[model samples]
Target: MLCYRKHSLFTKKYHIFKYDNEIHLGETTTKIKYTINLTPQTMIDWSINHQTKQLNGFWLIWKKQQKFFLMDATTCNLFKQTLNGIVTYGKHQILYEPIQSLLHSSFGSLVKMKYLNSRDSYMCKTIQKSLQYTDDDFYYQIEILQSLNHTNILKLKEVYNSNKNYHFVFDFPEGGSLADLIKTKQLQFKEVQLIIRQLISTISFIHSKGYVHRNLKPEHIFFKESNNLESLLISEFELGCRLVDFQNKHPNCRVHGYTAPEIKSKIFTQKCDVFSCGVILYKILTRKDLFDHESITYDEKMMLHLINQSDIDPQYQNLLRKMLQFNPELRATADQCLTIIDAILERTPTFSNFLDRFNLDIIYLIYL
Candidate 1:
């Protein structure tokens, strides 16, 4: 929970609760933080660097005048940065960077640090050493991920192998993840289609490079800090494995809907990713899971029919059928899915679905 008690010189106050789609003004001493909700468009002008994981620049409105302040995570103190100097609320001299709050805790908690300089801000991801992977295996995986140069994949800057855990350094994104966004906003069709196209292309690139993403879903997908949808980055490559010399065990996907039917059988190919993407496509369009999130209970007789095709465009439904086919061989390959995505984008005139928009081109963008 975010907390702050107003101090002298800080007559005005604003507290921001961070999320993926939108940041909300949770509480303020003034009672009115913002007239309405805000996105990156509304936050066009700001002095703070978006990349800093700690509290950044934010805006608040009071007495018909707009005010801005930079947040200090250490003491929950707010400061206004101006051309002349900084106007602080509390006894603010100089604060050395401190370890801030944890960004995520479940999937191996990631701790974010407050940076004295904007460039010093970074994210630390620590994983427990498991029996499946040895020191050499972890290093090999990191090596593969480091070699992967793609805009859609998360960058691994440095890695440290310790006795108890493996630590990785990465640039922090301002926005959280697609999973975080979906919790609040019902994604529009056009937006979902665009995200789908980008992810499919990236997954296809991985397949072409002889690797399978083993896991592909909303939680793994992240957006850059500025809430730019196009800045989607897929992280968590520890589960990734090469197609040829596969060794690690398949991840448990019971909670996440993006697991393929063939995953349990241990007989799959690149099409497993197609199945996973298909699950995501169905979800964003309908906001309902193929199987219940709480339990896998589903009426087998009406599985496909339950998808509510009437609300979705026909092309999406058709694509879902191909990708979600129970037979692995019958499912669409990465290239085939890419073709369908291209056709859909070409047909829909209004949507700016830049189908082949992955920059890293005709010869680019793959993940671990």
Candidate 2:
């Protein structure tokens, strides 16, 4: 038997009975027994478990040769619902109810609440405590995300404030992140091109609003399945990827190799993001760590040495040098990178050319 509790919205909390095949509704033990075929169209049936006297949360059950087996419900539902959507290949699936939340620290202590609905799969990060500095950093991140709209940039759906926290909800990307993908292999040129284009577009959108994503790294860029073909980048905002920790208020702030030299000297601007973008670009292209792994501290000297010694394509090397210039004024801007990429596309035959060679339009549609 299955019991159901009517909750907010169209969501129903249901429980299952093992002995008697019936759906229990509220206090009445309704004898109505209906077997619903598990499919994408089926809503989660949640109810209270009479035996345990606790909520028998929604779950998926399977029958094999007259034996019944039950597993976590949300996992079954998420798999079915996002069957056509993006998926992480080797990462562990994080399972939790809609009410579950996690506490994280970004500059100060914060709370992240996950929105579990199919359409509204998002996470809301809220500043739970403010110490030493003001709330300007929090407000800045919120304002920057709220002002922009792009496929690459994580969309800020809404904002709320309470005495304890300031919350901002943004879109969730299920494909994990660029950092995770990089662990697999060096991205093909076409994939890199697509990623760079999306990144450029996101940076351009941010610059147009007089802000910079100072913390532009692989982890900050999320990946999601765009369609049946390729993955999309989902940039985290609202202190998730923003330079919240490195704000002017904090005298001692750092982001290891991704931080430009000028930024180290307190001379920072939007170009700082471009510098970080260059490091990220080099990392994706070479599938190498920006810095050495054995060092406990961020070895700036070693990073500089590697930057100079790395044998890369002359064109790419030139761009990297320009981006990492010690002088802030000498560094390339996001707009400049876009133009350079356009020129590169025009002058250089790309993997797209190879696609043309094979007449692989389907592959092109999948990636490009």
Give me the candidate number with maximum TM-score: 1
Where is model 2 poorest over a 10-residue stretch in terms of lDDT?
Answer: 84-93
- Write candidate 2's Cα lDDT for 259-307 as tens digits: 6656556655778788778888889878887754344234556766777
The candidate 1 region of ten consecutive residues with least summed lDDT is: 83-92
The CA lDDT of each predicted structure is: 0.63, 0.55
TM-score of 2: 0.58
Clashes of each: 2, 8
Task: After superposing candidate 1 on the true structure, give the runs of residues whose Cα lies further than 4 Å from its correct spot.
Answer: 1-107, 115-120, 247-256, 294-301, 308-310, 350-368
**Positional deviation of 158 in candidate 2, in angstroms?**
2.6
Candidate 1 residue 52 C-alpha distance from true site, Å: 20
TM-score of each: 0.63, 0.58
